[model samples]
Target: MSQMNQPDLIGIADVAAKIPAFLNKIPNLLHGLKQAYLRTPNTPTGLGMAFEKAVLRNPDGNALLFEEQRYSYAHLNAWANQIAHFYLSLGAQKGDVVAVMIENRPELIATVIGLAKIGVTIALLNTSQVGKVLAHSINLVKPFAVIAGEECRVALDEIRHELAIAAGHFHWFADQDTQTDAGQAPEGFVNLAEKIDLFPKFNPSTTGSVQGKDGLFYIYTSGTTGLPKAVIFSNGRWTLAYGTYGHVLNLNQEDVMYCTLPLYHATGMVVCWCGVIAGSSALAIRRKFSTSSFWKDVKKFDASAIGYVGELCRYLMDAPPSEQEHGHRVTKMIGNGMRPNIWDKFKARFGIKEVLELYASSEGNVGFSNVFNFDNTVGFSPTPYAIIEFDKERNEPVRDTKGHCKRVKKGETGLLIGKITRRSPFDGYTDPEKNKSVIMTDVFTKGDAYFNTGDLVRDIGFRHAQFVDRLGDTFRWKGENVSTTEVENMLTEYDKIVEAVVYGVEIPNTNGRAGMAAITLQPGSELNEQDLKQMVSTFKQCLPAYAIPVFLRIQQQVETTGTFKYQKNQLKEQAFDPQKTDERLLVLLPNATEYCELTQEIFNNIQAYQYRF
Candidate 1:
C-alpha cells in the first residue's frame, strides 16, 4: 500500500464544496425522511403504494428495459395488476408467504409488485440456489405456494418433494413474455401466465388495506453457522429504504439506470429499484452480468446511471480498453463495495461523475449512503450507530468495568453496531435463536440493544465510516457472503474427505477474500488426480459458484481448539503460501475448469495479479 496508490483524503473543505448540491436535495430528502419514519406499523403505505404513484406520474414512460425488450410503466403496471387479481382469485391472502424463483426479468418484478399489492409476502429465492440449499430456503418459510419461472422449473422440481407446499400449488410462468407467447407449462405446474391473461388490469383494492407491519419479503441470508436463514423484511422496514436511498440517488424521469446485478439481492431489488420509482426513471437490466456485454448495453440504453458492486468494477478495470468504454451517458453510478484502492481509479476510468456507494445488509437496522458523494467512505449514517472496540481472539466487543461496549477512537477500526429503536428497528431473521445471536443487549446501558453487523469499519470524521472486513465465519466474495460453515459442511459431506475447515483468504488487488479450504483425507483415501477433479465437480453441484473454494490444501488433520472449533485463524495466516507450508496446494485459477498443482511460479503469478481470481 504505497502513498501514490492510496485514495485522496476527503477533507472538511472538500465536503464543504458539496453543500450547495446537498442543500438542493433538502426538500426531497426531508420529505423522504418523514415518509420513512412516519409510515408506522398500521400505515397503508409500502412498496406497492410507491410504485403505483410512479405509474400515475409517468404511465407512458419507459419503466423497464431488458435487453431488446421495452416495457412502459403503464404496460408493466397492468401486468402486475393482472397478477395481483389472479392471485387474489386463488385465495392468496395477506401474510401468506409465496416463494418465487425467477431470473432477472420483467416477470420477477411484476410478480413482486403484484404480490405486494395484494399483501402477499414474496420470498425471493436466489436464482443460483439448487438442491438442498434451494429446498432449505423454500421449506423454511412454509410458503402457501411456490411460483417459479421456466428458467427455474428444473431446480424447483428437484426439491418439490422436500417442500412444505403441496404439489398442485406450484405455479410456473414462461421465461418469455407469457402474455404474448404462452409457453407450454410442465406437468404438475399451473400456467400462471395463461390463467391471468383475462384478469382485470386494475390496481387491486387490497392495496389500500395492506399495512406496514405486514411481511413484504422473506430474503434469505447464509448465516455464519448454517444454511440460509430467512429474514423478515416487513413493509414497515421497506419504507426506510424507499424513502432514504430512494431520494438520495435523485434520478429523474429522463435518466435511465443500467443494472446487471442479481435482483434477488437487496441492493438491486430494493435500493436500485426504489430509486427508479422515486423519480419515475427507467431501469435497464440484464439476465446476468457479462463484462463483455456491459458497455454495449449502457450505450444501447443510453443509460444515465449504472448500478455496481466492487467486484463488478474490478472486472471492468481489469478488462482491456475498448472504444465502446468511452463516450457513454453513464454519469452516475450507485451501489456498494467500491473499495478505497480503486475508488478514484474506477470513476476516472469510466468517467463517472457520482458514485453513490452505500452500506447496508439485507436485515440490518442501519445503513450508510454516499449522499455527499464521498470518495472512499461508505458515507454518513443518519441513524444511531457505534463503531466499538472488538476483541478478535475472544470474538466479542470489548467492555469496560461498567460492562458497556467501548467505542473506538475516531479514525480507528471497530465492530459496527446499530442501535435498535422505533426509527431504526431490527426486523431480524425468522429463526428467533439466530436473532438472539446478533442482538447485543446492555450496550452502554442496561436496557439498550444494538444489532451487531458482524463487520468492522473505520470511523472516519463527520460520522462517516470506511468498511474494513467481515468477522466471524462469514466472508464476502464476489459481492456474495460466503459462509465458511456451510462450505465446510459441503466439503466434509464428500465420502473421501474425513474433515474439512473453510475460511476466507485475501488475494492481492481483490475486493474481498477468496474461499479456501483445508481438509484431511479418509484413512484409505488418496489425493489422486481423479479425486481432485471430482472434488471440483462435487462443489459445483452442492455450492453456489461463488462459494466454491478457489484454493485447497491437504492437511494431515484439521487443527481444532479444546471446544472443538476449527483453528481457522492459524490456517488463514498460513493461507496458500507454498513456502510457508509443506503440504500440497491446489488452485482453481480464473476460467480454469479444474484444480491444478500450485507451483512456486504459479503462486508468484497469482501474487503479481497475473490471475484475476
Candidate 2:
C-alpha cells in the first residue's frame, strides 16, 4: 500500500477490532433510544417506578449491601413505604419539599426513594455543608421539613435557630449502630427511625399521581463559585438515567456495583443508583471513599462494576500497589472526569475491562457516555448538541453577523450547548434568575433556545468529544488560550507531582491573566533544582510555549470539595502573593530553563509586566 493508504489501513484495523464491542452494545443502545424518543407524556416514569418494578420482579433479590448489613428488595421497599406513609401522616403532600441532610447510608437512599414515592421533592443537602452554607441551602429550597441523620445532628443543631422550618418539622434518623438514644435525637427533633414503625408498610397512593415531569430531587452544586445552587432533577431525567446507564451499560441481576461516591452528587444519586435499580442488582455502599480500603471493599462485596470520579481513580492510583487491586471482580467502571493521561494506566493497573468515562453536570442538559468502551473520549452523544466558538474574555459564545452562535471546526475546542426541546428540556436551577443566566434564547433562529453548558470541549469526530476544561478554568496567556485541565493532566504525569491545580493570575499591565499552578508533591519529594529541570523539560515537550504555567506555588496539600473536585477559588484569590500564603513560590521567567524562587524583584517585574513571554 502507498504511504497515504497505510494510515487508512491502520484506522480500518482499529475499527475492526472494536466491531464486536460495538455490536454487543447495540441492544442496549436501541433500548435507550426507545426510552429517550418514545416515552409517554404524563406517564408515571421515575425512580419510584423503577424501584417498584425491580421489587416486583424480584422482591427476594439483594438490593443494598452496607457494611455488615444486606438489605433485600422487599425489606428496602417496606422501609421506604413506611417512611412515605409517615410523611403522609404529617400532612406532607405532592409538591412539598423535604430537606434531607445525610451521609452515604441506607437511610439516605431510603429517604430519597420514600420521598419520591410520596411525590415530595427531596432536597439532597451536601453532608459537608455546615453553618451558613448549610442554612442557605436549606432555606433556598424552602423545605417543609428537615430530616437529619444522627451523623449530621450537630450540624443541624448549630443552625436550628436560624432555620425557617416550623416547630415539629425537624426529624432525625439513626445512622450509627453505636449511637445512644440521647444522641440519636437532638433538641427539638423527632426520631424518624422510632416513628417509621408506626406507619403501614405498603405503597402510598401518592405514587399513582407522580408523573414524569414531577420534581424528584433538588441536588445542590459544589458551590465553588458561590453559595450552592439547587438544581432541579425531574422524574423524567431520572427515568432517562434508568434507561441509559442501566440498560446501556448492560447491568444485570448478578452484577453488583460498588459506589463510594457521595450520594448528593448526580453521578452517585441518579446515575449509579438508577442503573442498579433498573437492573435489579445490588449496590455496595460505602460511607466515604478510602484509598486504603477501596480494593478490599470491592473484593469483599465481589463487585462486578464500580463507579468513580476522576479524583477517586487518582487517589487509588497514587496509593501503594495493593494485592487486592488486580484480583477484584470489577470488569466495568462507570462515571465522569477520567483524565486522558491516567485513563490507560488506571485501566491497566486495576484490570478494568471497560472504562465508561462520561461527561455531565448537575444543571447541564447534555450528557455523554463512553458506551462503546472508547479511550480518552467522553464517547458518542446521541443527543442534539452544538460546539460553538467561545470568547474567553467575554465568557460567551462568539456570534456571527446574524447573532447566531458559530460552530467550531471538528478538532477545535468550543463552548458546549444543548438544544432545548420537549424531549430534552433543561430542568435548570430552582432560582429563576439562575436559570435565566444559563439559558440562551434565539441562538440560531428567532425561536431557538439552548442550555449553555459553560464547558469547553474538543470535537473529536464521529459525534465523540473530549472535555477540555471548564469555561472559567481556561485562561489566556500571551493572547493564546490555555486549558488548565490539559496542563494539570500533563503536570501529574510526572512521578513526583501528585496533584496540580492551575489557574490564572492577573498581571499589572498584561492583556490577560498569566498561568499559575498550585501543586502538591508526592510524599518524601522535594522541589529541588533537579525536579524543576524535569518538570520544565516535560512542559516544553508536552505543552505549547504559552500554555506552560508561569508561576508555581508548592502546597503541602491541595484542598478539594466533598466530591473530590479541586477547589481553585481560594487559591486564585491568594495567587502567588508572598503575604497571602506561606507556601514556597517559584517562577519560570521567559526563556528560562529552570524555576527559581520568586524574589521581591521578580515579583515586582511580573506585577509591572516588565518581562514579556
Candidate 3:
C-alpha cells in the first residue's frame, strides 16, 4: 500500500469524551441567541438595522468597550449619527464611497455603521499600508472623502503630494488624544471629532430610504495579484452570512468577543462587528496583536469568545504553556486558517470546546460554517460550492474533453469554486477588468458561471472540507494575500539578485504565513546587509509592511523542474535559517531594517516566545 493510504486516522476520542461538557455549555449561549431574537424582529434589512433599532430601544445598554472607553448603545448611535450628519454636511450624497483609515477603535465601528446607515459606501483601508500602495488604495476606491486618524497623518501626508484629491476631500479624525475632546484637524482637512462634539445626534438619514441590496461597504482584495480590487459588500450579503454563522455557531448576546485583528479586515468586520450587532459587546485592541499579553487581555475583558486567523493561533501556540493557560472564560472561537498540524494542540491548550472554522472570501457569495463543530473541517455551506481539479501550472480549472469539470472525490484535494449567478453573485471589485479575471463563464454548462476562489481545498465528504494551500502565486499573511510573483519581481530588480523564488513559511507563532525568499545571486556578485536593507526598504515603500519578506536565503542557483517553474516546496521547507539548510540565510529581526545571521540563540528565543511582535 502507498504511504498515504497506510492509515485511517483515529476519531476525535477526547472530543467525544468531552461531549457532556460541550453540551452543558450550549444551553446558556442558545438562550442568549433566543433572547436577542425575541428582543428584535428579523427584517429584510441586515443585522446593523436590527442592531440600530435595538440600540434605540435600549439606549443605556453597553454597546462597545474598547481601550479604556465604554460606549453605550446611545453613545454609539449618537456617534454614528454625528458622523452620518458630518458626511451629509460635506456633500457626501448617497452611494458616495467614504474611505476610512483607522485602527481597531470604537470610531472604526461607528464609521462602518454610520456609513451603512447613511447609504454611503465605506472603503475600509488597511492600517499597515503606507507610501505609494496606500495612495493607490485610496485612488482605487475613488471616495468622495477620506476619513483618517491623526496617527495616520504622516502616512497620508507622505502620499498627499501625489494624490489627485482636493483639500476639501480629506477629513481627519483626531484620536491620538482621545481623552480630551477629539482634537481639531490640521489645515486643509475637516475635523470630524470636533464637529461631532458640538452637533446634536441625528437619526440615520437613510432610514427606510435604503434596502438590503444597497451597497454598504467596499473592501479591496490584498493586491497580491495586481492592483487591489474593490469587493462591494451589500447590506443583505453580510446580514445573511453573519446571521447564518451566528445561528450555526451559536454566537450569543452576553458573550464578550475579544478581537485583536484589524477591524478593516473582513474577519474582524464579520466576527467582531456581527457579534456587536447580535447584542454582544466586542472588545477591540487598537494596535497589533501581542501574543504575550493575549491571555491577560482576554481575562481582563472577561471575553467568552475570540476571533482569529491562522497567525494568531500559531502565536498563541508558541507562547510558553502556563498553569493559567486554560484559566480564562473563553468557550468558543470563530475564524479561519487554523492548520491541521496545530488544530488539536491549539484547541487543547486554549481549552476551546467549539471552533467554528470558516472558509469564505471577500468576494465569494458562498461560505462554509462548521455547524457540527467538526475538529478540522471548515464545515459545510448551504449554497452552491464545488471542489474541482485544478491545473496549478496554468493556474486554471481543469476540464475533461467531454466539457465537464472534474469534481474532487471524497477525501481528495481540488480547487474550491463557488457558482455565481443572480442568487449567488460574485459581487466583485470596483474594477470591471479585475472582476472579470476570476469569473468563469459557461464553466460547467452553457449557462453556468462560477467564481474561482484561488484556494486549494480537500473534500472530506459529508459537507465538510479541509483547507489546503492557496492556488497560484499568492500567499497569506495577517489574513492578507502576499503575491510571490510581486515579491519576486521586486527582488529581481536588485543589482545582486539574479532570480527569486518567494513562498510562505510556517513561522512558530504568526498569522497566515510569513514571507521568505530564496534568491540566486548574479554571477560574481556578493550579498551584503546594506544592499539587502536598501532593496527591502525600497520594496516596503511600494508595498504594505506585511508583504515584506522576513527571511532571505542567498543561493548560487535556484532549482527548477524541466519546465523551468521555480520549485517553492523545497525552499518553503528549508526556510531562512542557515542551520536548517545548506544555503546561507539571513533573518530580519522585528523593527530592524537590516538582516542578521540566524544564530541558534536567536532561533531558540523566537521559538521560546522571548521576542515580542
Most accurate candidate by TM-score: 1
lDDT agreement with native, every candidate: 0.88, 0.80, 0.73
For residues 1-613, write the lDDT of model 1, one tens digit per residue.
4322334445587779989878977888887889998877889988898889999999999999986789999999999999999989989999999999999998898899999999999999999898888998998898999999999999888879888787778999998977679798989999988888989998989998888888999988877766888888988878888899988888889999899999988889888988899989998999999999899999999999888999999999889999999999888888999878888888888899888999999889989999998788888899999999998888889999999999887667899999999878898888888889899999999999999999999887678889888888888899898788889888876788888888899999998999999988988667887876888888888899999999999888766557344367778899999999999899999887788999999999989998888
Alpha-carbon TM-score of each model against the true structure: 0.97, 0.77, 0.86
Error of 2 at 164 (Å): 1.3
Which candidate has the top score in lDDT?
A: 1
- lDDT pick, better of 2 and 3: 2
For model 1 the local lDDT of residue 121 reads: 91
Look at candidate 3 and give me any clashing residue pairs: 230-429, 311-510, 311-511, 311-512
lDDT of 2 at 439: 88
Could you tell me how far off, in angstroms, the CA of residue 142 lies in candidate 1 after the best superposition? 0.5
Question: Model 3 misses residue 222 by how many Å?
Answer: 2.5
Off by over 4 Å in 3: 1-44, 177-180, 280-284, 323-326, 393-395, 489-501, 506-512, 518-525, 554-584, 589-592, 597-613
lDDT of candidate 3 at residue 536, scale 0 to 100 = 67
